[model samples]
Target: MSVDVSKIVRSHEGKRGKLISLLQDIQSRYNYLPREALEVVAEQTGIPLVDIYGVATFYRSFSLTPRGSHLVSVCLGTACHVRGGREVAEELERQLQIKPGQTTTDNEFTLETVNCLGACALGPIVVLDGRYFSKVSPARVKQIIKSARAGKEEHTADGHVFPVKVSCPRCNHSLMDFSHQIDGHSSVRMTMAFGGKHGWLRLSSLYGSFNLESEYDIPLDTVVNLFCPHCHAELISANVCPLCGAPMVPMLVIGGGMVQICARRGCKEHRLDLNGVNV
Candidate 1:
């Protein structure tokens, strides 16, 4: 599909700090930013091409090259490394027939290594398509690959779901609403606006869960703008949703790293980046 770069640029016209958002939209449409689209963005927005490239390369989330359908990330942090993270990664390479930072021949999977995933207790972690697998053994690599190829979710170790404590990325203030709990954990509270209606939204603190309580019954596919309850800064990020082409609302994971969720109601696209890890 040909990208209408002009239309995307026009949508963000006169918006401050829109370059990141514009690039995100283009990447979301094409799976990666194409050179032609970058030129078009520069021409239409009057932003220099060099500056555009700088922004594209600066963020680890932005990929200049085309990415495969499924992203496979292995964590090799200090804790994971001692726990045989390298062996797990080597097993993945052996199974997928590709090394780190390389996609499979069929463009089905891209393998990458990250420093950490903030789940130290669960070392030897492997994240496939946003799902976490902890304490992965080299022996399980083949099954994981097969499951991913078949589009089936492999159960995490012990079927455990991790809870995350997040805060406002802007003010560094805790966004955890202890008084309002979801999934038996403190909810991440934020104010939002959608379809001209403003309301409070509380999201489940669980990483893999998508349960959220909102003041309004937001219609499906309604893209909302989220703001921090304490700092009032917009929670918008430069990244776009992988599943839906909508802006991602970002929050700081209490320990270290960031968690972003799709702003479009009913879209469960979310990502967890830890210690500069991008997957």
Candidate 2:
């Protein structure tokens, strides 16, 4: 499996502050950052190999070693721990036959334990390929693994789509527009600006659904800035999208958590943090 490190490097040739993005692209292509890829990146970009390694190690998302096709992360944070999180992890280990931080012999799955995924309210959470499973149990672990083995997409009993009501993180004003519904739920309304065009955008309030309507045609991969329609405060969060390294647009989940979606058009990376834990 030879990776075209040169082509990857050429894509970001003159772009400043693209090291993380460059590494992300490399990892996305190979499933993990190969040592040869890193070396080639350093040589092509004139960045020291040590610096590249530093960037790789600094972010837990970047992996220097080979990873399995599917990633399974079990939360062991205080909230999850109290809710039989350990038991869930043990069940995953039993089913997958791999300990934490180890990949299965078949390279199908890798198990990992993280301190927190910021969704403490949904304790005993298991994240498979960035999809959050709330209140995961030992029995559910088997189903999840089975689904992964069969390469079948897992959907909740009700089609895996659930509605959420969000407010502007800064102004606390409700962003839900009942007058305009999407996916049979109130749409999340926000003002957006991209490519010198400013207009209103409505997003499906469903956490897992990607249906959205924008005033302007947003080109795929284009990054947009989002603002609260009420207070007009920018909704951009400091956190970057784990999937595409794009700026995350955050909305306060009405009850107790925050939901963030990638600002880049067509990137289906969204996060739900019910307990507001940073990590």
Write model 1 residue lDDT over 6-118, tens digit each, in one string: 87887777665577667766776676789999999888888899999998886565677887888888888899999999999999999999988788889998888887765
Model 1 ranges with Cα > 4 A deviation: 1-3, 156-160, 163-189, 194-202, 211-224, 228-279
**Most accurate candidate by TM-score:** 1
Q: Lowest-scoring 10 consecutive residues by lDDT in candidate 2?
A: 270-279
Which residue segments of model 2 deviate by more than 4 Å? 1-3, 157-195, 198-279
User: Tens digit of lDDT per residue, candidate 2, span 1-279?
Assistant: 234778878876765455765776677678788998999989888999999999777655567777888888788889999999999999999999988878899999888777775457777878776567888888889998888899886784222354667887555689999999998878999999998999999999877899999989999999999988887777765457989999877676664345678999999888654421222
How far is 163's C-alpha from truth in model 1 (Å)? 5.4
Maximum-lDDT candidate: 1
Q: What is the lDDT of residue 147 in candidate 1?
A: 92
Decoy 2 TM-score against native: 0.65
Pairs that collide in candidate 1 are none
RMSD of each candidate?
Answer: 4.8, 8.2
